[model samples]
Target: MLVSIRVAAEELGVRPETLRRWESQGKIEAPERTPGGKRRYDLAKLRHLAPHKAPSERVTILYARVSTNGQRDDLVRQRALLETFSSANGWPYEVIEDVGSGLNYHKRGLKQLIAQICSGRVGRLVLSHKDRLLRFGSELVFSLCEHFGVEVVIINASENSTFEEDLASDVIEIVTVFSARLYGSRSHKNKQVMDRLREVAKEVSP
Candidate 1:
């Protein structure tokens, strides 16, 4: 069926100007023109432009996360920041919020995000910070996204939080868990281990 330039751009996930440029560069066949000089596109021919899915059908996802409920305010701020950033870019988007340790891979939001990506339902994944996705193995998820043709956008390329800070935090959480498991949650040895880890963390963290 014949469609207008605007509709073609929407279906192809590009601007009408991009279509014009492609035509000029001989990248795509020229569009039909009405007597009034309006460009008309044939949807049948343009399906090749978006081989995976119609770009309009794949949503832009803004993901936000915090390590704990204590950081609920930070999670809220992350959501707001992501919303503002995507809105500024004129992206049609949805925000997914998660509250869990970055070491946790079983977070509901994270699972949902991965599921959507695998299903080819997501066009883009936007994050306020890379660590917000996962402290460890985030690269694996990124690889999955790349395989699925999902674009990953990190809002802040350079982290405001240092690796040492994150490492210390992760160490403390790990020690807390293992100490409890080995020495029992209420055991004095567990307390001592946690205390010692805190002291070492303080020494190493900036």
Candidate 2:
């Protein structure tokens, strides 16, 4: 299962330079070279990258995430549950865990998992919940998985009980920020108003 560099690059939907960049960045295992020094990629590896197989026939990825270090134990629990799920299904699995805000896209573990997904080696992905994977626009990622023929299984697909609480937090944070700005903008007028009220109160003898 050996292929010339051009064929391999074409199959990967990347330019040859991209493949060379992948090698340089340690994003992929280096391809072997021929005696005359031509690059060759193992076709098996390339095939594994995006095998057109049914869901049950492919390797799985278990992704676990927590918003902050405070939820490290929750992250562990997520991994544990995913591991159990993967085991029951009898699929070879890898767990990718991250401790960062779901709103963030730059987490190291998240980036690595995406790269793996892009390589097409992952057949399916299992997550405890949707927001555990991201706080917003999770559908974009799901669409990417669909485009790549990767299945996404959210163990809990229903509305989360704490969704309102989380949403409230975001709303409150926004309100508090703007409330401060609203006051700060009229500090001079507000001070004058307060002084007048105090003077009237004194005139009325409390």
Candidate 3:
């Protein structure tokens, strides 16, 4: 996909002039020019900024997550599928699994993933589905990955939710977060609230 310099800079959390400077400094690939002489960047190439570390030292990561302990079987299956995919591609990969709510950003697995990415030890990230990373704000992680020149691969990109489904998800996420905050995560009251909300969510969903 092609995007204007402003869009690319915004995604990277950098100023537009920084992109122009990087282009001039050979830090990034030169962008395509429009008929009116405006610059357009290839989104894919823009993601692969020059890495700070040697390629051989970086590892590909296969990450999976499930909302609760009840989904252990699903998590295992996700791990196995990711391993098979990486093996087929002959990539040296490691698997990171999390049993937590997607709305929670403080997951240990997620923290470790961010640390590795910041340390320049991640060459790529592979996911079975996009939301497997987070219920929301997955793009922030992707932006960090892009800033560090880590390639992102999503095996199932067609699993997008309809508007109604998304609304259901958002409702559930809000309930889950606020219930935990109001009643404490392990409190019986929170459990009761979640149980009722889940039913309501199902009713509203397709």
Which one is best on lDDT?
3
Provide the overall lDDT of each model, using Cα atoms, as 2-decimal numbers: 0.81, 0.72, 0.83
Prediction 1 global C-alpha lDDT: 0.81
RMSD of each: 9.5, 16.1, 6.4
Please provide TM-scores, in order, for all candidate models, with all chains considered together. Answer: 0.68, 0.55, 0.70
Model 3 RMSD, rounded to 1 decimal? 6.4
Tell me how far the alpha carbon of residue 10 in candidate 1 is from the true structure, in angstroms, after superposition: 17
Pairs with steric clashes in candidate 1: none
Candidate 3 — which residues are off by over 4 angstroms? 1-57, 180-194
- Whole-structure CA lDDT of model 2: 0.72
Among the numbered candidates, top TM-score falls to 3
Provide the lowest-lDDT 10-residue window in model 1: 48-57
Candidate order (lDDT): 3, 1, 2
Ranking by TM-score: 3, 1, 2
Higher-TM-score candidate of 1 and 3: 3
